[model samples]
Target: MHETNVGQPESNDDSDGIDQAWLQRRTAAAPLILGVVAIVTSVLMLGMLFGALGMRAGIDLWRAGNRRWSVILGVALSFVGVVVSVMCAVLWGSVLASVLLSRDVLRETERWRGQRVAAVECSMLSADGVRVSSLHPAPPMDRLVIVFVSSGIDACGQALQDLAAVAPDHPTCSVLLVDRDNSAATTRAFALLHGADFPVLASETLLPEPLGSVAALPTLVVLNRDGVVECAVVGAHPRSELHTILSGAQPVVATEPKETQGP
Candidate 1:
């Protein structure tokens, strides 16, 4: 009769411990589950509203050292969603407006190129106070390739090195580098790093009409012997394309060896 068998204290403790473990597991999985939901929502919304949030969550998860590949894939998907959303907005808003906007952009680009070409035709004072036409003095070659560079830009340095590498192969083409900042120390360092043979010019006021007003670095300008800007490229060009530009502008010089007769 009397007292019922006392429940085992150890069993109660074990049950309590199992419950705590289950709770901890659920708590740990909550953030991951929320992240997945956010990513799915972002995709459904075309990334217009929740795309950035989802991307941030993915990045945070990666930083937290959890599911690296999943986070990367999620980040990529979020980026695509954002881009798609933007494209959709642009396309759906007004097709005519988009076309007109693109046309205006192209026109502006062409206008800038024209200004640069015109600037190349103008005269500029060199570092030595010598009045030089275009960016640099016209080289004693059939064609001239002027590479605009800056002190801190990596692309400019790469373009300079590319030109230097191809300089020997193209005898008729001369490669000249113009430092936009006019930093003598940087110019010297660049020359030393790349090669001493590549000529470097330091002029602050060079191309005052175009380059002086704007900060467009790493431009490649190809000119004919007549000092006319044949092709004015606004960014770094491929080595093959650079070669093509030079080769296309190569002047056909006809020379006949004079015959000498000795008596």
Candidate 2:
């Protein structure tokens, strides 16, 4: 009877060991899933915060109506929220993804940080035809891509269509198109035709000679984010070429001097 009791204790010990091993495996996997959830939640929260701020600013702008100063202040504050929102999203996602996936978050963070964008102002016929200049003081050493098209060139209609297709895939890049003529009706029509998500400026003023020399119609130029002209293509280009340009590598087209373009 005493021998039988001793064997029972050994059997119980083995059962406990098995249970512990099972729990250990579960413990290891839980963090990866939990970490992902935490990271996603953090990003979503930030997005909500920025989205709310933008809405508030928009409302305030509407209330102020033609009050230029009030509208300007509201717009400025809204931009602040946008910057913060983006930082939070990237940081949160990178940290969590790194921890869960056991990868370097720094590389991911840098990938996002490398992106630089310029909002080109297009005024076709107006005295204030040059709005792209306002985005200066941009990140140092950024490439400048220019779209110089006139109404005669289907600048708005086709340009917007091309942009909408490309923008989502290349979130790290900036795109600006200057309409050779500032035709409000044409601009509106272009917007209606191609659900353009980026800025499309209309100007009546002809693009300067140097810019005209680089790009003619349905043209795309890939510039280094430093505001230097990297490569200029006279006409439409393929997706692969654009991707190459975004990576700071020259596309397999014309290598141009920076002197022809502005940052």
Candidate 3:
């Protein structure tokens, strides 16, 4: 009878050992499995959904004190998932904004094309209210190119350069750079850097009500010989398009030397 009782204790010890082994296996695999799931979901662009699951698994493994490397990898994958999700969101937002802006610009262009626009009899003023006629020509040109710009914007400077290059091509088209907000010094600096041949004017208000309000910087407006608005582009346009528009108008053969030139 004593021998039988000792044998029973041995069998119970074996059962306990088996149970412990099973528990350890489960604990070791948990974080690894969860980490793989998180990584896959992140690659699929699921954002934070599976990331939370992986993070929870990693935390659980850390508490269990098993599979340290698995926990580390799982946490790292979860972090990557979160970052990818954020980047995807920003990319989507930019795409949506671009689509909407394009639609609005197309509609505006169609509405203003071929319509007669009133001449803006506005005078250009210096920062100190000094009248600058060179920046604002005294009418009589075949076509007028008015570009509204804000200082320190690279896109605006590029637009100015493009217009300046093409302005000389079409003698009839006079290019004017209108400053939205900037000191005379800043404007001069930009003009110098870009080698602008057109006049730079400082104005608080947008000229010619027909062109509507200046909602965006670097708005380009083309006026015909009769003071009619030919086109108004809200953003920077390709040089080819600008040239096409200028080419449609009659070129003035003579060059009038009244205003600003490249320094």
Candidate 4:
């Protein structure tokens, strides 16, 4: 008589041989499927979902000492897939935000081009010793540039530092840092840290409209001597561009919400 039962078949999971349960459930192929699926989903920019599942599967396979070339490939590809997914997600999100903002809120903001914004009180700035101007110190300024900033956004903070860097190439315009979302003490410290010679304004109570209601960060509101807005630029601009914009006649065209590319 010929015997059918002989030896245990090889298993990628177990170093010695396949287990009894492994015979019932095809657990060996599960990791490979998950890892491959994760990669596919990541490519679709749904990496947050399948990428995680694939990564977990990969980790399990690695920990179990799966030495098969297919499983190893799955493990490696899963990691790569996760990274691609994250990068794609961020890129897509930024593009969407920029497009939507340009269509909606930014379009509405454009309407305020010729409207005169009120001069904010000097009490908005955290000055301990120096006498504060009752209103914006606009009497001596030919142009007033109101820069709305947020403490949360790194670009806004960098905008303050950039303004400081360009302080040497001073403009006839006076730059005012209006805190859209910032604490008085932190705003004061932030300005001082960046060596901002210009006026930095914040209020414990919400300031008036346009200034208080502004949604975009690092937005520059350029005004003439009459407090009427000549132009408004929304984006993170470098010191050189900022100097030119501040020093020039008027900025009618606004830059797209993205990192400025230098000529």
For each candidate in turn, give its C-alpha RMSD to the true structure in angstroms. 15.7, 23.7, 9.6, 10.3
The top-ranked prediction according to TM-score is: 3
- Order candidates by TM-score, high to low: 3, 4, 1, 2
CA lDDT scores, all candidates in order: 0.58, 0.48, 0.66, 0.66
Off by over 4 Å in 2: 1-137, 140-142, 152-159, 182-185, 202-209, 212-215, 251-263
TM-score of 4: 0.58
Clashing pairs for model 3 are none
lDDT of model number 3: 0.66
Order the candidates by lDDT, highest first — what do you get?
3, 4, 1, 2
TM-scores for all candidates?
0.49, 0.38, 0.71, 0.58
lDDT (Cα, tens digit) per residue for candidate 4, span 17-119: 4554454245555556666776788857765566566667756766776655655666666677778888888888999988997677677676667666666
Stretches > 4 Å off in candidate 1: 1-35, 40-139, 208-215, 249-263
Candidate 3 TM-score over all chains jointly: 0.71
Output the TM-score of candidate 2. 0.38
Runs in model 4 lying further than 4 Å from the true structure = 1-41, 45-99, 119-121, 124-137, 251-263
What is the per-residue lDDT of model 1 for residues 82-154, given as tens digits with 9 covering 90 to 100? 7766776676667768667756644433333323233354333333443445543355676667667776677
- How do the residues 1-263 of candidate 3 rate in per-residue lDDT, one tens digit apiece? 45555535555456676798787776766656665666666645674777777777778778877666767777777777767766776887888898898788667664555555554455553334545443222456667777778878988988877777777778766776677688545775686678775555654545555455566677887766655566667777788888987776433232222457899
